[model samples]
Target: MKSSPSARSWIAAGVRHELLTRALPALRHDMAAPVSVIRMALLMLKRQVAAPTVDAAACEERVALIDNQVGELVLAIRSLRDWELATTDDGISRSALVGQCVMLMRSAFDLHGVSLEVDAALDPQEDEHRWPAGAALRYLFLGAMGYLHDGADEAGAIRIEADGANAVRLQAVKRDPGTSPSVLDAHRAPRALAIDAVALQSLADDLGYAVTLDGDSVRLVLATGN
Candidate 1:
């Protein structure tokens, strides 16, 4: 039987399946957005070309719009290609993995009415930090993360910081859902993140790392020593 830590990790692992399921609809939109515009532009261009009275400047404008939309379509296609090619190996670049995962799962986040953003502080220096490929997806979805001590950006994006080479800080600045949530959601609100904290701390302790939980955020670190 798996130990408690392993069991929880197993639970976290299931979230990836749910995330991909929710993300597909949004991914479809990403691929379709540029195509939709390109189609509209083509229709306009076609009308201009077949006009009984065509203006050179108007035709040029339509052609230019179509060109721009086509460029956008190319970028969308390329992003899909990259997403499909992303690796789920044991080790991967933290930044690239985080970015690709964010692109893949950000829409799933939207279902919870939250947006995830990583601090630019986690530049190449930290992005160079190594994390297991599947580990990151688990980490973000797990809800055990760090400080609201001015933790978010002006746009109120949840900040995922690089705590260290093998650590991550999650700071949530959430929005009001404007409804009386069920008891479960009320308990699960950002203000009550200690659930994740406690669970992670138990696992961290077993692994010789440490976790700290405050009212707003929890910082999980892979400490060099206790």
Candidate 2:
């Protein structure tokens, strides 16, 4: 398969289709957090409203809290909706793209007794670092995370790091002494909810990246100088 730009676009569409089909549960799961926050805020608002002495400031605060959570819910949903094209685009920041992937999968991670964390060694304001076909790498990270989630019989964390241009590393840190499937097994998501190996590799190749599984780490390394 050619790793040309058009070909990569088609691959990204395939991933988006798979996510919409297989990752629906996870997508729904991911929204639960913000919804829970809204619910709690509503409860507080009700109490504040019903209180004998209505504290206007407290009532306004609860309303603001609800509004913020609603905004988060909207952004969470739009992330999934926007990602079909976004994933194929180049020059996306490593941190921002990875954060969206984490947002889309965090609830699923919690369900499987795993935590997902991203650690970037770059200034959020100044980091202009990017790789070719950068956005689809979010699919790769999500796939690796799904791999970790599938293998966990105990609690664990997928510590993802973005360092040096064009590379992101996900290290599976088991909280206790336990085993996990290698990063290669990230394709083995139950119900086939993850990105498959062939498309994943093609995306990596188009991005000038190499995906490697070393012990507990899944690293995406891009070629130097573009």
Clashing pairs in 1: 145-218, 146-170
Query: Model 1 — TM-score against the truth?
Result: 0.50
**What C-alpha lDDT do the candidate models reach, one value each?**
0.53, 0.64
Write model 1 residue lDDT over 1-226, tens digit each, in one string. Answer: 6568677655534433333444467667876887888788788878878989887898788778878878877776664433321445554565655565566656545444457778886555633645443443333434342223223322234667877666666667655455333532332235332234344554444334456666555565533243
Of the candidates shown, which would achieve the greatest TM-score relative to the real structure? 2
Best by lDDT: 2
Worst 10 residues of 1 by lDDT: 146-155
Q: Write the per-residue lDDT of candidate 2 for residues 1-226, one digit (tens) a residue.
A: 6468887767756654565454577677657889999998898889888989999999889888888889988977875644453445654576666776776777666555567877746325464666555445555566556545554334378887875666777777776454444542363355654444555555555444568756566667644323
lDDT for position 222 in model 2: 44
- Against the hidden reference, what TM-scores do the models get? 0.50, 0.55
Residue 87's lDDT within candidate 1 is 46
- The backbone clash count of each candidate, in order, is 2, 0
